[model samples]
Target: MKELDKIDFRILKILQQNARIPMTELAEKVGLSSTPVTERVCRLEREHYISGYHAHLNPHLLGKPPLVFVELKLQSKSGNISKISKRSAENSANYGVPSGVGRIRLPD
Candidate 1:
């Protein structure tokens, strides 16, 4: 990725706060023309700096009620743990669970 200048930082800051902000409004906020701002955004995405845009939704509103985190441990370490972890992640992704689960390594 190329080095980001002041304008690029400003654009990212604004977008992080509100990804849905229209390009015209973003350009005005960042003191750039809409066309340039749009191009910058596209470049950022192409560079993988911007993975994707999404809407933040309330889980309760979706009838899931409150959510909780559960730490999992496996007995085996010879790839069994990795296999189980992959399966869990796949299930969560498939079900579209908000704040979907992930694996975290614990320090010994």
Candidate 2:
């Protein structure tokens, strides 16, 4: 494996903050030409230093409802799930049950 240098670390840091940043801009920020920056980015990817990129969006700003999701791996889907779901929707702020994982929309 190739050892990562200062330029490689800079590229990673910049990409982490804004993965959508243009190559030229990123290169300029790291004080390198675009060609070398591109090559470094590719090498970083090949080395598994960069796994993936994602957006951290603000749901409220985007006009999205405050919905919460819970993930679970259930051994079996049971009737208790229905009962809990109905009761939650009727009574608590929970608003749903866990059929593996529940979709609970928070109250406004």
Candidate 3:
């Protein structure tokens, strides 16, 4: 991978805090005109530096009840983790879990 310059780093930092930032506002924050800023963002996406955008959703607004997390301890380590993970993912997908709602890790 190539090194990111100051502009790219700044853009990334701002976007990290608020992915929904407007192009005009983002350009101003990074000290660039909208056109060049847009092109740079497009290039960033093409280079896979910015994989995709996401929105934080409100479950209640969506008519979804409170979310729950469960951790299961498998009794056997003999099973292939890949298959187990795939099955779990399939189950979640079938049950309408948003693809972007990824694994949540709690600090130990």
The 0-to-1 C-alpha lDDT of every candidate, in the order given, reads: 0.74, 0.76, 0.74
lDDT of 3 by residue, 1-108 (tens): 567899999999999999999999999999999999998888888999999999889776776655555454443554665565665676543332322233332332
The weakest ten consecutive residues by lDDT in model 1 span 92-101
lDDT per residue (tens digit) for residues 1-108 in model 1 = 788889988988899999999999999998889999999999889988888889888765665544444445445545666666566766543332223344432222
- Order of the predicted models by lDDT, top scorer first: 2, 3, 1
Best by lDDT: 2
Task: Score every model by TM-score.
Answer: 0.62, 0.56, 0.57
Worst lDDT 10-window in candidate 2: 91-100
Tens digit of per-residue lDDT, candidate 2, span 37-58 = 9989888888899987777887
Clashing pairs in 3: none
Q: All predictions: root-mean-square deviation over Cα?
A: 9.3, 6.5, 8.8
Q: Cα deviation of 76 in candidate 2 (Å)?
A: 26
Model 3 alpha-carbon miss at residue 3, Å: 2.2
Model 2: lDDT to the true structure: 0.76
For model 3 the TM-score comes to: 0.57
Error of 1 at 45 (Å): 0.4
List residue ranges in candidate 2 displaced over 4 A: 57-105
